[model samples]
Target: MTFNLNIYETMALVSLILYLGKFLRSKSSFLTKYCIPPSVVGGFVFALFMLAIEMTGVATINLDITLQSIFMTTFFTSIGFTASLKILKQGGFKVVIFLGLAALLVALQNTVGVSLASVFSLNPLLGLCTGSIPMVGGHGTAGSFGPMLEEIGVVGATTVSIASATFGLIMGSIIGGLVARLLIHGKKLTTVHDESSKMPPTQVGDYNEENHNILSLKCLINAACLLFIAMGIGSIVSDFIQLTGLTFPSYIGAMIVAAVMRNLYDFTNKAFVEKEIETLGSLSLSFFLTMALMSLKLWQLFDLALPLLVMLMAQVILVGLFTYIIVFSVMGKNYEAAVFASATCGFGMGATPNAIANMDELTNRYGFVPTPYFVVPLVGCLFIDFVNSFIITLFINFIS
Candidate 1:
């Protein structure tokens, strides 16, 4: 029987089954639960598995790059949908200041990545990919761009993306709490507006006043049609934009189209588009991140050396200060708003989900959000990433 076991496939099955088991067991809390963010554990454990198997000359890892692309695209669509242009409107100068500082910090972060790679005698581009590019930005950005960098000759981009995401997840939760508590003590503002509640549904067009069946085929049809239309229109417009000799990330173009379509739907009072999009997006992100991580080739990193680790440390320190002192202090309105802004800053510069997760943990534990949860999710999932893509391209070109 040819003893075939694709290492990544095996690891994915193992990780998912393990995760499901823990879920079924009703385990709780990030601190105690064996859930150290499924991606991190999945990727890490899988790498170890591959190392063991490969060393014995038993198996090799094969990543399905095409599937990775699809999942990554869908995930980015979700990220784009979550952006809230409204809050950014109200935020005005604060948003400007925050974006500017964040842009500079990310540039510094890139520089730090290059420097670290040089120190470790590894490719500097690889350092950038794993350091802050994707991991901190979450699965959407990291996985979406990993293969692209790989095409550009940056090896081990996937692993670095996973590692960065793990670090971002950890830092996001901690920084959120610490900032919230500090703001309270410093008397920077009054009243925390975090209402620890479920993330509300996206605003649909008209609430059908006539209470109808929840499982109606029409509802499902409407939801599916909306997504289809959004996807279709988004694709056409994005292509047109690219055809015009301008460069934009694939997701950004899709999101602008989606957002525009959504706003237009709102005007026509038929705005039920993107309903349950999050479910689809989340599922895609989970699998995408999983596949991206499952093909861990640890042996490749044996030559990475120590200089790279120091560069990462420097970048982390820089981001921390940039977030705390500049972004938080200057963020807008009351203390609660500032905290949210601080967290948002992290998301724009780090990971959007991490941003919402941080805010979610904060509100869940504390209790007051002046800005609204939907706002953050909207911005994180949609608008910020679009903006970040543009910003990144600009930064790259400028540096080059």
Candidate 2:
């Protein structure tokens, strides 16, 4: 028998799963120590349950994941909102250097993945599924490109890509903080102030309910308005760009629009609450990740698990060496480099949230360094996708 879930029902279940994951994280010391997102924990559990049932040939499920793209786009758009030209300028050479480093990593990941896959006698194109397509591109990119690969005769491409992303998410979260920890302590790096200060002001703000409740509401609404406008205009831009025969993710246009909006808002000296928008972005990311994990078709990945693990391990090793030898050195070999090293692991294998989580955890332990807080997100969250898309395309054509 087949069970189908509508979009609303899927959303309801996702929300519940998120809550359950949060509860479990609070109860589990291991989860807390690793800084695992509740959505990942909860969604993985559901996926495993589904896999068990499917393997038993008892039942199957079809989930409506339409909202997943919407949430993904929304989350990325919020990242764009943080892309103020002023901040980028203030970020100085470190931001430019790090962004260049991140872009180079995309090509490197594909090279390593494809090279090893050839050594393993696997299809070279299949390696892309395991490479930056999922590693740097995250689950969304994995899902988007999976079927295209399958159509070109790469078997189980979607499954391989998704599984790689899932593994990346967990491994990224686990090791990112550890990398930063080792670098910070080993190098005797120091923080200038409390790490919490690196967070958006609203996150740390204490407001009297009577005086600030209305203000808070207004801020949220304004953020929503700005996000909606960016998304709306972004869709049009994405469609127009597609007409030119060069494809991009829907979120790319939204991100560009948001960046422009942010710079404009900053230039005009407009009053806007960046913290509230960041909060909204965080919310969207949680929901999007939960939905992505919940929708995984685990049965599709069974045969490829061994190869996936081998390639992913290789990817991890490369990431570690690159961060330590390259990212740390280029970012100045200071306290912020340690933090950026952690962030590298996040988006290098996982996504922006993982990178942020990695940085947040390390900062909490060693104090906050603002450079990583600014540079990592701008590079990983905003710029990397554009560069990654181009590199992935180049690899596809090269291998094909």
Candidate 3:
């Protein structure tokens, strides 16, 4: 038997799964420690259930995941909003250097992945599933590029990418602290005392409750409008890029358009409600990821399991060494560099949140180091995605 769900049904189911995932995360320390997203947890469980049913000859499910693409585009569009060149300049020279290091890692990751895929006699495109697509790119990039790779005739790409991303989350968390500890203790680096380094204060008292609610609503509406506009224009941009005979992700155009709009606003000194846009993007990402995970074809992954494992293991090793030797030394061989190394391991193999978590753990255990806190997030979250995406696109076009 086969069960089909329409778009509304799919959305409802995804929402429920998200709640379930959140509840599970609340109860499970392992999930919390690893910083796994609730959508991933819930959707992965649902996928597993579907896999079990199929294996038992019980039933199959077909989900109308039409909204997945929209949600994905919206999230990437929000990321584009964050790509403010003005802010990059404000972050100063270290941010640029850190971004360069992160970008180099992206290239190295693809090189390792593609080279190993050849060694295993697998399609080089399949190697990308285990490359920066999952490692530096995390689940967001994996979800975006997985389907693209599939369209390029790479079977099981989505499954492999998702699986590799999950693995990265865990391994990134585990190794990040260890590497940082090794650097700090082995080199005997002293912690810096900077009590003045803290987050800037928010303008919370400017609006009363009624006015605040009204403002929030207005901001949300504007954010939605901007996202749709960018996405609409981005389709044209994507088409234009395709005219160049290069394969790029569909959201790339939207992201670029969004970035341009953001910078224009910055140039005009106009107030943009970034928090509202970020919230909207987070909501969209949850839905998109949930739908993507729940719709996974797990059976397709069986054939590529060994090669996938090998590729993932190699990536973990690469990230560790790269952070320990290059990132630490180049960033300056001090306490801040150690923290930066840990942060790099986190985001290099997982997500920026994992990087933050690693830094938080280090700060709490040792003393607080402010430079890494500032520089890592700026580079990892804002700049690295743009760099990684461009590099990945080049790799794809070159290999294809």
Per-residue lDDT, model 1, residue 17, is 42
Instruction: List clash counts for every candidate, in order.
Output: 20, 1, 0
Question: Could you give candidate 2's per-residue lDDT for residues 335-393 as a string of tens digits?
Answer: 88887888899889888767877776776666766767767777776567667877887
- Show the lowest summed lDDT stretch of 10 residues, model 2: 201-210
lDDT of 1 by residue, 1-400 (tens): 1234455665457457447533543454662221244554555666677788888887654543456655666666655554545546665554556556555656666767766676667776676664446534665577666666666576777666666655666655555556656665565455533334444423322222233324556655665555556666777877888786544556656667666656665557754535456556666766776667666566765665355456545655665566666666555545655556556545634565456555555555455464535455444444545655665555434433
Name model 3 segments beyond 4 Å from true: 192-215
Error of 2 at 299 (Å): 1.4
lDDT of model 3 at position 39: 91
Tell me the lDDT of model 1 at 131. 49
Error of 1 at 291 (Å): 1.2
Better of 2 and 3 by lDDT: 3
Candidate 1: deviation at residue 59, Å?
2.0
Position 23, candidate 2: lDDT:
88
In model 2, the clashing pairs are 195-368
Deviation in Å, model 1, residue 105 alpha carbon? 4.5
Candidate that beats the other on TM-score, 2 or 3, i.e. the better one: 3
Go through the candidates in order and give the C-alpha RMSD of each one to the true structure.
6.2, 5.1, 4.2
Q: For model 3, how does the per-residue alpha-carbon lDDT over 26-112 read when each residue is reduced to its tens digit?
A: 899999988899999998999899889988999988888999999999999999999999999999999989998999999999999
